[model samples]
Target: MKYKVFVAGSGGIGEAAALLLREWCEFETEIFLGDVSEENLAKAKNFILQNSQKTSVVETILMSKDGTNEAMKSAFESCACLLDCSPGTQAPRMARFACDFKMHYANLTEYVAETDEVIALAKDAETGFVLQTGLAPGFINVLAMSLYRKFVEQFENETIEKVGMKVGALTAHAHQPHFYGFTWSPIGVATEYVKPSRVVRDYEIRQIPALSDRETIIIGGRTYEADLTSGGAADLPDYFRHKAK
Candidate 1:
């Protein structure tokens, strides 16, 4: 059976995800790439077609800046799942469409306010709603929890001294003055730098300013600076509150 998947946003992440779904998904998939820019939509469609399998179908829908386009709504209503790779600020709107369309909703936004709104909206939703499902908050959080569980089982200890997690999407070469290139959204990077981070310290969940505590570390013979960032903690601080530091 062919499942229709709607991807709202034709940016880098959305294009890559749509291509992956078209090529590697378990079942046959018909993907619709929606974006406010026709150029981006065309580019995304071409990229997907170049990399997709013959059995998969790729379509495009021209979305409005406000996300109120009737064509976009029709596309959403026809899909089985809505993968939102748009900006964090737009997460709530995309999630609302998902809930109303009764489609599984997943988003890659780490904006706490928008995520909270989606959580409230999806609390009673029959369809599944996944939020902040990107690199840091998504995979790293799960990896940390798994390692924590293994540590407890292996050492027969209920608590540990400290749990620290760091992730970076850096380019091969670094220049001076913020030695980072734009691998992801620059707005997202700015948000991480400015927002307050939630972390467990001294066996308690505490809020601290991002980039407050910077440390130098060497990985694979390369040195890099690391610091606290928001939206990467996931639910660890909440789960580990009063459990471990």
Candidate 2:
């Protein structure tokens, strides 16, 4: 059965997921390559052609924010799964679009509240809504669930004393201007870094600063620093805390 998949972002994340979907699934996958410009759509298309065979690629709608909502409506009505690879703040509208269209939703937003909404969507729906399915959120969620399941299987009743996670993405030959970004989103990065966070302090929810959790460290040959970031805590605590019984 050729399941139809629709993708709504054409930047690094969207394009990458679409390409991988093309590689892995025997489904009819189409990407609505919406960007704020035509060049971006062209670039995404070109990149897709380079990585994937030029078949009837589901369909590519080169619409943007200023672009019409007509195509968005059509796409929402069509695809079985809507995968979002847009900006961190753009998750709600995209996810809402999928929900209104009666389609399954997935995305790579590292924001906790956004992910919470996605999870809430799954409560009454039959479609799959896999939130935070990328590097930190996706893989991290899988691993955490695995460990949670393992512990539950092993001991059944006890409080989980602690959970600590460390994950990051870096580019080679790191530069200071963008530090670790090719296409930098300074505001978004700053917002995340400066966002006040909630952490399990002595087994109780406590507010802490994300970047304030920073520490300098020595690596293989150089020293670097990283602040604690919340990638999976929004929903995991609820899952783990409940299962710790």
Listed in order, each prediction's TM-score against the native is: 0.93, 0.82
lDDT of candidate 2 over 66-146, digit per residue (tens): 434777677667778888777777777777767778888888777777666666767877777778777566787677668
Checking candidate 2 for backbone clashes, the offending pairs are none
By TM-score, the best candidate is 1
- After superposition on all C-alphas, the RMSD of every candidate to the true structure, in Å, is 1.8, 3.2
Model 1 Cα displacement at 128 (Å)? 0.7
lDDT of 1 at 172: 83
lDDT of 1 at 52: 68
Candidate 1: residue pairs that collide? none
